[model samples]
Target: MDSYAIKYIGLLCLLLAFVSCKKKNQNSLPETMKKDFVTINYAKGFSIEKPASGITIIKVYSPWPDADEAFTYALVPKALQTQPQLNEKEFDAIINVPVERIIATSTTHIPALENLGVIDKLVGFPETRYISSEATR
Candidate 1:
């Protein structure tokens, strides 16, 4: 092959190797309270950890069906005015306690929120027409 062809092949091979290596760096969660996180097993889909008082870490495994990875959310008290001392990579999002507003996506969640006495916090729901609860309607 000519010099140009040989160089092109070398660069292509290097790019392919880099892409393969990057894919291997991704991580996933089992939600069974793996070795790294504290064993506050919430369920097969999530794990709860309390690294500090009034601060909760909820690691949701497989956010979507058969998802390859997981997401972690930090629920901190609004009064704290600060986040917990955890790794920057530990959580994907941070939410405040006493959730002021809610947008319940599932009908199943509505009953539970109502029973918890926090149905008033629901500001938005897609399927309000399907609800039979007079209080929620």
Candidate 2:
């Protein structure tokens, strides 16, 4: 495909992603929901936390080489009616949980996305030749 076509597709994907995610959850999250979480012990790349029920907080540290700081994001379950109020500076983004789509840069992330049953959500990736998965290609 030409550059124009590639750009158009990427833009369309982004627009579609944005539109699909704009819906609000009609039910408010349960106040009594318990926190369920996994412990991140070895990987310095990221850490996960559950500060509240129906919310998952992720902090990625030095995701890239020479990165000085971590990026934080809040993930709320789709069933949640409203996002909990949080300090603005605490998170880079507050996204609905169970992401609908993704654009992967590194091939290392492909397997995980696939395993999560979201590989079909791959909107774009560079160097298609490097991708061995027939499903992805």
Structural similarity to truth (TM-score) of each candidate: 0.59, 0.56
Instruction: Please identify model 2 stretches exceeding 4 Å from their true place.
Output: 1-38
Candidate 1: C-alpha RMSD to true structure equals 14.1
Give per-residue CA lDDT, model 2, range 1-137, as digits (tens).
Answer: 99999999999999999999997876755655545567877776887877556578888888799998889988878887365566668889888767777889998988888798888888889888888888877
The list of candidate 1 runs beyond 4 A from truth reads: 1-42, 82-90
Most accurate candidate by lDDT: 2
For candidate 1, write residues 1-137 as lDDT tens digits: 99999999999999999988884654755543344456654558788776535577888898889898899898778776464454567779878787899998888888999899999899998877987787898
lDDT of 2 at 12: 100
lDDT for model 2: 0.80
